[model samples]
Target: MPDITHSIDIVIPSYRLEKDYILRIIRLSKPEKWVFKYYIVVDNPNVIVDEEIARLAASGDITLLINPVNLGASTSRNKGLEAGSGEWILFLDDDIKADERLLHNYVHAITKWPDEIGFIGLVKLPPPPTAFARALIINGSMMIFGIAEEAESFAWGATANTMVKREAVGAIRFSTDYPKSGGGEDVDFFLNVRDSNGGKDYKTLKEAVVYHPWWNEGRPSFKRSFRYGVGNSYLGQFLPKYTYYDFPNTPEALFLMLLAFPIVIFIAPVYLGSWGQLFIGFGLVEVIATLFQAAKRKAPLSAAVAYYVVRLKLAYETGLLWGNIARFRFAGIGARFEYKGRKHGNGFFQFNTYKIVKWVLYALFIYGVFL
Candidate 1:
């Protein structure tokens, strides 16, 4: 007989309101030592709730809240949080499939780390069904949750499979400043929680796993990537101390600048002359060097994937640049942020390498133009 001193409210905000997925979570076996309640916030007001889901709600198995209007994800989550009274809150995406041991593992972790105010679970991805999906994995875009699987502690974790103690998260709700389509709200929320809790990082629990399906049937979606970029750009303003501006720190920025070389040469060939060839050559080198690094890292790479990667990178960076422009931060075009004191997980290597390459390219360009 396990102790029942605490309760957990599982909060899910969904526009799709997939009945089967919701049922699967409701049907998951409850943890012995913890009580559970389901709080499903329907972001779509027009969609009819499934009969089975309605019945569950009527029977008290699930508390369903239908928004009168389309209130995006962050606001929907806040609505769910307001209705729940559990000591801990477990947030899950409507599309995710939870493991049988999901609740059990969280309970065990709670017991083991009583002082922890939050916990991050592993988000496992199913094997890619297409080469494009595989490329996403290889490029690290599909593995956004992979960090939680490896790191023992992290600055923040995705809400798709994260749990937090209610007391520690007091007054710290997901920020609506991000794009309504969704992006950096999760990081902002968790980072705020950490800050409010005296800098206590969230604990990562590999045993708690949820499988997330690839978006758009595993095909590349530049729109989604662009939106994510736009959302992430706001993080710098939301948390300035952890983020800073730099020149050409991102592959997207480098690729974009490199792409501009041809246009510049085309518009004013007289001014650049043969010097434009050097810029073009440098761009080619950048592409080839990236491919080489990918291959060296054992990442899946092919002509098709290379093309997709470039297109996606360009789309994301363009959105990021647009975001910076929207915020009127023209001076901080290439902003970067640190995670656990490291920039993008491998700060020292990635930051310095990009910096050196960018400056070298600039020096060469200057030399060709002037000398």
Candidate 2:
């Protein structure tokens, strides 16, 4: 780390967090050579804090703000940010503690990266051991809480363990206009920053890692994954930033999925005159590739495990379908208005004149050709 000197306000918005988790974060966040202040905003004031944690609050080592009502992380975080006075505000999840040198990496990255960089993303270390956790990790989605890989110009990052330049984040705040249960306000909050802030990007300090106690909470892991899938539609619905993360774990997988739907229909007749043998070839290659991917995993995977992973994948799909329907139930009505994005056909509700034609072609190609 360079000889950099800047104050950081560690903001934690808590809701029913464990005492041990709270203490661990409070301890690990206090870097030896750094000037930092810690603020823990209790979303529900009635949620009891242990004696040691309360003492720390009384001693001024940590500041505790109480929200009269439980407004969830997004709203509580905004309150913490408002109270924090520092050059940088490091937003951390109440349940997660950081790497020993996490703060150092964030400070170093801020000093090192270009000024256009608005925030530094941190890696969420391998989650706790559980069947659901393992499945969620293996069946990955970019929207999974506190997940980041590779230091790139990626704008979306979990606020669970990230540092943001306080000045760069002007009027932008986590959107409380979303569902209390459906998440993505954290990810969308930063994406909105990139959109309005002269195209500012966020980078990862890969070593700035935190341990997540995955699937330890009361909510079933599958339910959480499903909720995340629904929550994802809110990104495109509100901000117009296409932060829609795909359900397929990889780009190849995504392409194969899209291709499979049509390509399978394109085949399935006599292999000669009407149907494509090419589709069969593609399917064989895809199966081999998928098996190869599963084999390459560090842990030996079994057939049962693979099936469970497939189930998790479907959970995401279901969530996306349900979420979009719920979010855009009135989109057709909104399309009629002469608004910023609607009137000129640039909006999401554009009249796709060729839409039905494309589907009709698929239907005709499938039945007329195959049968």
Candidate 3:
């Protein structure tokens, strides 16, 4: 390694977690001498500090700041940015295992494209997801698009694995209007960065990578799942104005009319005449569109379902849009529902029968196209 000054600082915003993970990152990343200091921002008061915190503090290389109340990741990170004294401040999720090469990759990338890049994010490769995790990843729809070889013209979104120049941090402070805890802060910050600096773009370096834990600590329950659905909708408050033109299609309403071309094409030649073949051609176009959406997520062939998948996709997106409208219209004081580890049994809602009936109705609706 060339002679580099120890001016870089790394901050990890942590809620409650097993201390071993934090210690592992610090110990593993010890060889990287470019780091000047490490800060762990803790929002929970009861979280027990271990020997690693003590060691870091003793070495004068690490410090801990505990907030009086539980703040969300956005606020916690902003506080870290404010307290931190360094030229560049890097953010890492507490759960991640920071590899030896992590710091060097970030430093090298920042130096090479220093002016063009506003924020540098490590390419996050989450491990093989669990059944629940897979369902959520597939259904939740937060994945990125485009191939590495082609370098498609799209935004490479920011994740927990990101670094920012400290001076640039003030321009894009996280939005406080969002629900204090979950969802949308990362997207909001990156979008803020885009708008604030006159037309400057952020770039993603493929070599700068980090490994993220694959799944939730345990299987997510139905209620937890429902809350996630609702929270995703809450994100529209900040992001709606920007209008994520993620796909190339007519407006969603017009797109549905276009969806009919494939069915028209399939039935045209045998039943009608050469004119029907034109309809079939249009149908092929829709299939290509659906494939484009799936490819954006890096969706796998093994995960593919029968033809009814399109209905489910429409339902999820429509549900999200309606959920956001409902929340905004009816939101009042204390509108938020906080989930702690508590068990409540309400028999009016049934799970097993619900899935069966829902899928059956969806299949019938899709099958109606042929009828």
Which candidate has the highest lDDT of all?
1
For model 2, what is the C-alpha lDDT against the true structure? 0.61
What tens digits encode model 2's per-residue C-alpha lDDT throughout 74-118?
888888898877888888888786787777677677667737445
TM-score of each: 0.87, 0.70, 0.63
Q: Give the runs in model 3 whose Cα sits over 4 Å from its true position.
A: 1-6, 28-35, 123-129, 136-156, 217-235, 244-327, 330-371
Model 1 over residues 1-371: C-alpha lDDT tens digits? Answer: 77778899999999989887889999997766678999999999997899999999999988999999988889999989989989999999999999998999999999899899899899988888777777677666655487676788887888889999999999989999888889888888999898989888899998999999988788767888788888888887788777765566344445455667688678966756555555465555555545654676676677888776666665666777777778777654667666553334332234444346555665676676567
Using TM-score, give the best candidate's number. 1
Order the candidates by TM-score, highest first: 1, 2, 3
Ranking by lDDT: 1, 2, 3
Better-scoring candidate (TM-score), 1 or 3: 1
Rate residue 65 of model 1 by lDDT.
96
lDDT of each: 0.79, 0.61, 0.54
Taking all chains together, the TM-score of candidate 1 against the true structure is 0.87
